[model samples]
Target chain A: MTCTGLSAFPLTPIREDSVDERAFAAQVTRVAAAGVDSIAALGSTGVYPYLSRAERARVARVAVEHAGDVPVIVGVGALRTSHVLGHVDDATDAGASAVLLPAMSYHPLTDDDVVGLVETVAAHSPLPVIVYDNPGTTHVTFTPELYARVARVPGVASIKIPGVPTEPAAAREHVARIRGAVGESVTIGVSGDPFATAGLAAGCDAWYSVIAGTLPEVALRLARPALAGNAAEAEAENVRLAPLWRLFTEMGGSIRVIATIAELLGIAEQPCLPLPIRGLDGEQRRRVAAVLEALQIS
Target chain B: MTCTGLSAFPLTPIREDSVDERAFAAQVTRVAAAGVDSIAALGSTGVYPYLSRAERARVARVAVEHAGDVPVIVGVGALRTSHVLGHVDDATDAGASAVLLPAMSYHPLTDDDVVGLVETVAAHSPLPVIVYDNPGTTHVTFTPELYARVARVPGVASIKIPGVPTEPAAAREHVARIRGAVGESVTIGVSGDPFATAGLAAGCDAWYSVIAGTLPEVALRLARPALAGNAAEAEAENVRLAPLWRLFTEMGGSIRVIATIAELLGIAEQPCLPLPIRGLDGEQRRRVAAVLEALQIS
Candidate 1:
């Protein structure tokens, strides 16, 4: 499979308590129309863990329907191996091109455990599987050795690492190490700020943009310069987007960022997060609004 | 509520991917018959998070039934709040006197978030809730200030702080601080090896013990001296149990220690831990077995 240069991470918005299917579909349509390369459904930005089994399946179906021709990679993270495999079945049935699997939710996992997880999921998924290593959220990092082991698993085709600004250098090093270790066997993607130009330059094949859920144009514009090998232009766009990145990161990572942006974009009827995640306080909300206004997204 | 003396915690055994309910019941009966103070169901030693909703409920029911008059506190921890609340409901229905809640599960929580969680659960729970602060497993510590805030919640009646052997003096200081902050509103329980005696002397209301699970006779003997205000004898018992404690702590934390001991004592048919918790390896198993034999538990 040819590597996609960009993937829109469509955030799963919650209305009341259940999945907001209408809002999700609308977001998918907007992403596809904005010329995103592909779309990922039910990621951390989408509050994947909070969704019930049926909701996950329905969201995958809705996202695929809206994507039309663009590939939709559905996230398949559940505490149980059976649940994860079941999610893969649902995603594949919903016509998803691949599934993103995070290892053993809510537990500090070992390297062997991750290898076992990738092997188990790979055995079940009909399509290629993507190993998502979001240590900031999952608290389990996939070391380079573990990444190589996971890459060697049959049907495992990609790895996604979080690209926070605090660790841009580390992210670049990791991408380079993973690419060297796994060769062309699997694609390496970075998910975080739009400033993943450095990571993309260091060997990251794709950028997974949370902002793409709302402002696909900005995401596409930011990546265009980077993809075209214009580092100077990409850096300029990065500086322009820095305020938005800081706002989102300060609002407590991707879930809140996606929800807040979706609400601002006027597509989501409500910004509801599952228990344990509260909406941004008054000051934070105002700051986020100011940033969005400056970006002309609102 | 009158403060009970040092409570003995027994390990619940796992066999064939399920709680060895029969063995667990027998163990409970033996511990209670040995004149132990109380039985804690689903502590870290119980492999709490690994059990399914139905299995955890069953364990609580069986433990309460076999425990006779001893108060049983069940562990209620899940990635989702709904599941944790469900476990609370099941435990209360199964005659549990209180529930032990871990603050960290799906996401890393802040102090305010934990305070909110305790209040929310306390409002819903039928039984009094004990805030379990196991930083080793959860990677989040509930500071004394946070505990003080949570203590104001109506149904939060106790705090369980794990003790560290190397820093018994520091544990003692913490116990004093917590007791002073919360006053008589919340009972303080220490859950470590060396700190149990010091914690009690330092004003902790009760002591939570893991050695109590596998060797109730030895655990009771150790605590009997402590509870009777005989420090010298208690310290001697602590020395006797030290080797076993070292073995348990070496295999892993509370869960592995409890499971290993249960197997050695013939109370658990198999050392079955759910996915991601691989039991002791052959070398470690041999070492654990030898330690149990030396301690006369086998």
Candidate 2:
């Protein structure tokens, strides 16, 4: 999973206030069937924090059961270190290859706190750990120094850097800075789907993708060219999803848009996201529908 | 509990990765014995997000059992609405007078999401709700318009607005704007200890004090005069502990500084915070200890 390929992140569907395991397994099986390099379950897009430990374990088992040969990376983030260890054990029991640990903050956390979390997980879990640096959600931003610190921990596999700067040189330099700190042993994966091509072109080892989970063929079209040194081709394909990325920015986040896409394309149930997150309004859903129809993505 | 008096929030002490129930009960009892208006358990200071449902329920029960005549307000915030509802039930079962619901986010929440959370809880829970707007922790800033919306809910008792503007005219205007939106029915309690006098002087109905949990006498010295229409007296008391406020800012958050203060006073054990938090380094603890001694706070 920690390689120069696409690791798809699927949104876990919930129905009647419970994990819709049937639809969720279908989503994972579809992504695996579409030939994603890896299936990363319960990422931010999957609403990991909104779920319980037992529900999360069930999702991990379903993902591993359905994702065929694609290695499943489970999100094992919690506010407490003890709870995180418990999740790591559950993920390992469910046969996940790696666990994505976001420095989930209730009180603002220091660099030392984040490092302590990664170290504790590394000490306890048998599976490889991905240091998930998602400042947008977690509030704890990781410096290159922090990344290098965690990368040195035993069983640490990949570092999921939030998005690279859009400019080619700056993105490359940013990636290089992280690379110089973390060295060649640990993989550097790029998230934030809008910058996927730029990050892959700039030497990020993997594209930990959102769109790929729902539309694997489409993400691969944009990602494969960039990973293979044809940045222009990838950039062109990525530009075609301009409406989507624009919608994501206008919508304030990508999860709702991705969920709407899943529902509109008959991939998951309507109102797929859990409670408190009312996926999208009717007008917004109509807009998503129009975009899907216009792009022939359905 | 929603009146113009101090609502003290006590930090839940953790020992060996479990809630030190005896120590926590002692903390609650100390605050109750000191005659605070209400005892708020499992607040940001109480580490509500880090504990499990069972742990939270136990903590809530302990707070109620220890707090004699003082009503206990338990914080029941969770990432999911369903889990929050479950916590609401637990708090009610423990005989909490009200439940504090911060719009805890993993994905950033829109006004609709937050309003929906409040609405759902209001619809189900027997206890009155405190719409907690601590953007410093939860990241969901509640605008005046949003305040008006949630205040319309049936059982909404209070709105814990974060620190008000410091200037006299501006702070009064700020509190007035919220008061106008929420109306006279919802008690406008203020958080952020340093701004206690300003918020109280500006017509905030309550002071949600953090340090009051450990040092009720100290917070009451600052808070009581303001509640009695003597702003200058409250301001003088607040200014006396300027060093304490400065330390809160320097330490990133008040939790660890307060935890260290508790440990130094022999009220709670060392390393009071849950792991991944690492209360304070030895050097930092020494500084906190020095502050307590110089100020005669210990």
Candidate 3:
């Protein structure tokens, strides 16, 4: 089914070096209570790369278990196609509503390759498939032409494009172009913090929020004005949320943001960041705490 | 033991969807026969990523199996550190003299992180460890400072640096600086075609080859002059092998190059590239044939 409005993409918080099922369940309850349209688990904010096959399945199951009636989209991009197909099976088994796949591995891909990937995933997926375009991490941007090609594939239900400012204008242009190309058969969702409002205004069917994990109310409030086409109110809310956004997008990016939020909220005792992520310390932690207090979140 | 003098890095040709073990064996035999000092398996020219864990182990086995008394170093870089460690175990089990570990997966690593990785791998490895730096693929350059840090780590026997023209001046400078920093404790091997001569002349311990897999005799013949300090002769041979270098660097870069050369040499029947690598077709095939014929290997 088409997503009608903004969906809160909560960061999948890890605790004790494993999937924090208790924290995840609580977060989902909060998101549902806030009346967010949907919940996405295992996005980059979830630390998709560090997770193992078993952990990924567990996270998907926890999201679906706590989601109640809300749809859950599970991220299934792996370095190998076999791993991706395996995740599709696991997601289906875990009761995920859909799968969000990124064309991030094995270097840049051609349109034909993207089409092939979509078709392969769709053929095996029990749920609808969502194509994720996050070039910042993947280094491979899915152009409108490629999305149009992927849209034709059966089982593909949505497209999630990151709204980072560093991305070229062509990325946003592709949103409208892809929508027009695919008609209403496919839904469009926006990710990234800075351009969430502009992306919705530019014709994305829904907005995904990273901050929604900790500040569900803030996300809900911002979406109220943004979805209603009230630019002034939405812009003000965005500015208020900007500090948290900056913290999350710092050195560790999404990983740090998600972990810090989990710790502050008492959902997780400590950050379980895998190797490659040096946890926030000293000034960074102080700044994060100050920002959360300023926003009245902690 | 420290590796001194020149070594031939022969490309392992792929034909007909699988590694032509016999052809690879033949190539290895030829490299040994040509009086080459040493040989390596599963370098970029071996299409390491395309092969499954089992397949990679087999490639290492085949190379060592054929090398007899000649020292064989197997490239064992994968996305996961566990996989790298596993390959090191497999290579040693297969009787490889040493293991070449590429910092291919986690790029732009902090100095501490890099040091930790080297220490962990060295601790686990049964054979001597060679740190392979192919920053072109890894997106993380290893500076002299970083190399010095790694060198201090126990069991780091050598470093394999790409001699590619992507950063010719930087490549030369790094070789000089790294040599001065590490001194006799670590050997430095040069990779990439363009700067192989310059690297050797500047005191690189050895020249690693991708074309050697296809033309072992030619690679051995050329290295003799280079190792004898005849830069002019080595440059002429490098020019002759230029076409082969260009072919392998096409499409998927090093991965595609190995598969294509394997097919041309009748070692493997078809290209066994994993997902994301579309096998070479038409123009690429013609180019491979032309290059093989020019090199008098066909």
Candidate 4:
């Protein structure tokens, strides 16, 4: 089935040095309760690449078990196709309903490289694959032509477009272009929580989100208007979510912001970021608090 | 010990799905025989990230064993600092003289982040560290100020600058700036095979080379005059090496070109490039052969 509506990529909570399974499961259950369509474990927000294979597998297993009726979408992005195939197997073995595969590389990927990667990965994967396009993280951006090529791969169910450029014109144009290229055969979802409303207003089918993982109710409040074709209403809510979005932009990634949000919401502990990287400082945390307070999220 | 002179990053040969140890050892032995100053196993040319931890450890072990008196610099770059620390231990256990680290990230790193990462990794590492700057792959560039900061980190012994802009003027200025900033405590070397002569003439201490690994005689033919301060002679040789350099430029990376070079020299079989990535096609292979023929390297 095509992935649709809001899907939560819940933060993989770290208690001490381990994946806090109880906290992780609870986060999934909480988002699932808020009526998100799917729970994506080990997504960018989940820090999949930073975690060891065993840790990732456990995260997926717990995610699937706790998701209940909500489908579980595991991020299976890796540098090598063999490694990605291994992750695909892990997702299937963990009982995930779908897998999100980003074209991850430390090198520049040619068009044929990306197409070959997705097709080979989809061929081996039992679960439907959602091609994730987040050039900010992977340095591999997919044009509409590239998306169309990936969409035609067997077992590919959807594509998640990243929120980039920030300018409403570029964001809107990008979504429209992908929709036109892929047509109705592939589901179109928007990632980068800040641009969800703009993507939805531009006719995206789903929101692959970060905020929804913690503040699902608030995320739903923002998404519902856009999903229902009320562009004016969605844009208004996006204005309210502006402070939080600014924090994401400032941090250069969602990991620290989401972790701080969870800590504020009392859903998780201070994130145990993979070593050499620390969580947000007091100033950043204070800003996060102010944003949450401004939005009245608590 | 500072990394200096013509250090070779020999391609890790793949036989079936595994690192071909015998062929890998032979490659190292051959380069060392040609009198390269060091041997860097698992550098970009080695595809360290594409291999599993076990495979990397195996490659490191084999590289150290075959390197003889030549210093073996193992690439220990990883996404997480914790993973990097693990690799440090692996490098130490393998008996490598030093470890080469690129500021590997899926996200763009800030100045503080880069400094923090290198300091932490160096603190935990048993072997001395060489900071690798390859923006084409990592998307992280180190300014002279940043290199100075990294150089002060206790265990960091050197920095490897890449041949970017390809223009000799900017390349020379970049090397000079780093040298001015860091002083003599940290050795500065250059990578990108074609830029070795320019780098050496620009006052870099070494050429951390790709071509040196497979075509050591030719690589030395270029490096000797440059090392001896014969700029005119080195530039002439660089011009002679221009045809091969163009192939490297066309491919956007050195992996395929080096792999093709090894195959042409009968050092190894067609690389089994981690699946979904095919070797050079007939046209590319024909071009590689023509370049090698013109160079008149038996």
Candidate 5:
């Protein structure tokens, strides 16, 4: 149950705008079968905010059921404190090993507000908490000082930072600054799939990844070496994924591209993402399909 | 029901983490009694995203009931398209005259996503839609080109643009640009209290005032002249209330400061904001109180 390796975040596939439970179970089972460190369900990659309480609870249950012995971490996000507490309760009742909590701001949360959210959730949920920071989407960035404050809250086990600087030394310094702030207690997990290996080389403990959600082996190629402290090997793996990373950047975000990957590989049904977020199709779908072929990702 | 005068946005007062219906009714009645053109319930100042569907429906009904002859524009924002549709249905059933729809992006929505939201709502709801654009919070800035596209969508009756540029000529030109996009059909309502008079003077059709929600008379002192085409009188009033506007700038946003104004006046109970969004207290509280007195707001 250590938070120190690849934690796969699978797509919570939708069929007709509802959680495709059968497809979701298959997604989880595949990632578990591929031997991930843990299964982090309902992260942004899972489209957490779009799902209803009933849907989220059911998804969490499905994840726990099919994830075998993989420690299941569910993302608990809502605009209101009480509503977030409701999600934490649902995550707990569904038998999750830990809960991933984000500021999830509709209005940008003040530092005091974000800290208060952490304290409230930590106080109520008996499970370990991973503080999620994705400023691009959440619009609430955490200074390392703030991270120091949040990670110290009781039951907080990790900090899932957006991405570290790509340069080797700067990434190390960045991780070091956070290390000095949070010390040895909380794990530092890097998100942002492209920078995953570099962040690991910088001494991050885990990769809370998007790519690992569907294509675990491809992600594991970069992760295993970096987690094993072989920077050159990890960097080589990352260098080879330049094409896939380009696809993510070009598509505006990882969700649509990843969903396209899932659909092309038959991991999930077509139009898996919630409505309003279109999955890539036509020429774009062909482009992703070509990348999958060239990289031999499937 | 033309969207062309001062539209008040009252806070949805919260006590014990539940909607304070009595206080809300009082707030609505006070605005209605002041003869404002419309009462826009559950706009940003209303803490719209924090409330439940049932809470929003009840608040919409209360606003309609207490508004007397005034039109009640209910904000029906939710993350999913279907949930938003459900809110629209509730607003219709509650006898709301129109519904205000913000992209309400938890994930920053694409142009297609936002337009799809408008098209979907327009297809279903009988009431007109106001495209609420507050990019500082919503994080989805609509281009003038995007505005033209959204305006053309059937049932989009208004566009509540954020603050216009400060300089008089610049403000006029900015409003004129939006004017060109939305044209004569869709009303252009201005948000941002500090920018309200300037936007109105610059040819915006309405002033969506947060300050007016707590103190309708004070807002009318400026709105009345501006709506009547007396820009000089409106400018004089805006300059006179410069201190109040400064508080909003210094405090980051209008919600907390306005909530302080409401609570200090006993218009609502203390801790009116939903949990995690702490109301101004102690010295900050005193600053707002002193400003209210200096401006003779109550």
Candidate 6:
């Protein structure tokens, strides 16, 4: 079970301060029912680090139970190796199929720091590790050289490259470079949903996506053609995904935007973000509603 | 009882995976015995976030026990409000007089977010809260308006403005602006050691210092003249401190440099930073040693 095709990182729904377990299970069932290839709980969209260890364990367990046949990927990334190792135990106990590792750092990590961190986790992890390179939040960029090094770690089953090249032409080249660097032994998944069309066109093995986590059909509409090598059709679907993508870009990030979408669609309650952080404003919600209608999401 | 004069943010001594309690207590005692104003344990220099809650509690306990006659300021900043509240309990239980709050954010905080966060934390804090504005690490810059707003939160006793203007003339103006904004009720402390001369000259009530945590005399040497309105003497001391300041700037930030200084002086063991992070390279260490010798710190 490699991380290939559409992996839905279902958002963890919150009803007061606690994880809305039934809502979370329902959302996982919804996304899994949408025919996604895999269900990735506790990725960025899932607010992994924000949840406590017990909360995380419960969320993972609920997600796995509801996911049925779909593979459950848990994010075990954290500041301390010990804590991350603790998370790994939680993921294992929860019966997760895989774990995502992002090198979360307050200080910039040296090459040795990053490489050693992955190697240590990978060596001890109960499940195959998917190297999550989301530098936007972590502030630790896994350069191609770093990715190549991380790919060699024994338990690293795949590499998720969430970054996209700004230039249209550079997209293919970027994917090619990483693909070429890591060889076929590692599966490459492109995240940051906006890049899915070009990213798949460039030969990445999967779309480890945010939009798919909330609106699976829309993500699948875009992914199918792109995965099938239909660039023109994929580009059209990408254009359709634009309105939703813009909402994601404009309204802070995917977490808030997805929360709005989920709420609008009555899929889940307000996202249970860690405090001082909340969901979209009324005006933002209005905009999302308009986009949902425009895109005919239902 | 206020965070006036020089408040030393002592580095946490980590040997293997655990805190070296004896070394940490001695380091706190050494800084306190230097006649500094206060001792701040578990600060950025203290690697506050890197340690677990239990470890943070222990560090705070030991530091408070050893810091005879001096105030102990514990860093209670965390990703979640509940976690910060938990740290507050730790600090209060350990007998800390004040707690420093840095709005640690993975997501860039909006103005409303920052204001809301501080108000929430301040209202619940067991100890007086010091608003820590370290944008370099937290990525959440408290604009003077934000600072003014945060300072107004109940229980917010002081604002530590670590940022200093690049131009010498602007230093006094900048501090004066924040001083005027927060009103006389609040004490303003300047950090970022290089800015000591200018920040102190700018009329900030205290120097929330990193270097002082390790090399107390050197920090006090600069602080004394600046506190006494001896501009020429302060500038001279700033000149003397230039070599050490260069090391802080060149080698990323204070954590690694302070770790090196503490190890060189045998004040603590080699800082066991969370994995993937190690102490400075051989050349960096050699340069630090040379600076310590040149400054005649012993």
* Best-matching candidate per lDDT: 5
Instruction: Name the better of 1 and 3 by TM-score.
Output: 1
Model 6 C-alpha RMSD vs. true structure (Å) is 1.6
Error of 2 at A171 (Å): 1.0
Write one digit per residue (lDDT tens) for candidate 5, span B43-109.
9899998888889999999999999999999998877888899899999999999999988776667
Report clashes for each candidate as comma-separated counts.
2, 0, 13, 0, 0, 1
Q: Which ten residues in a row have the lowest lDDT in candidate 1 chain A?
A: A104-113
Clashing pairs in 4: none
Q: After superposition, how far is residue B181 of candidate 6 from its true place, in Å?
A: 2.9
Q: List the residue pairs that clash in candidate 6.
A: A113-B276
Docking level for model 1: acceptable
Which candidate achieves the best DockQ against the true structure? 2
Q: Give per-residue CA lDDT, model 1, range A91-182, as digits (tens).
A: 99999998988874453455766777778889978988888888766777776777778888999888887773435577566667778877
Give per-residue CA lDDT, model 6, range A171-190, as digits (tens).
Answer: 88898889877878889999
iRMSD per prediction, in order: 2.7, 0.7, 3.7, 1.9, 1.3, 1.4
Give one digit per residue, the lDDT tens place, for model 6 in B1-298: 6768999999888888788888888889999999999899888878887788899999999999999999999998888777888999899999999999988887666778778878888888778889888877787777788878887888898888875885677997888889878988889999999987888887888999998998899898999999998978999989888998899889988888888888888888765455557889899999999998998876
Off by over 4 Å in 3: A8-34, A164-174, A177-183, B1-63, B74-94, B104-109, B164-171, B180-183, B248-252
lDDT of 4: 0.85
TM-score of each: 0.91, 0.99, 0.86, 0.96, 0.99, 0.97
Candidates 3 and 5 compared: the better one by lDDT is 5
lDDT score for residue B91 of model 2 = 96
**Which tens-of-lDDT digit does each residue in B1-298 have in candidate 1?**
3335656666656665556778888988988887766778887777676566788899999999998888888888765566678899999899988888887555456676677778878989988888888877766777778878988999988888877333557756666778777878788887876557666556666777777766777777777777777877877777777887677556545566566666666677664555555566788778888877787775
Residue A22, model 2, lDDT: 94
- lDDT-superior candidate, 2 or 4: 2
Q: What DockQ does model 3 achieve?
A: 0.31
| Model 6 global lDDT (CA atoms, 0 to 1) | 0.85
Fraction of native contacts in model 3?
A: 0.11
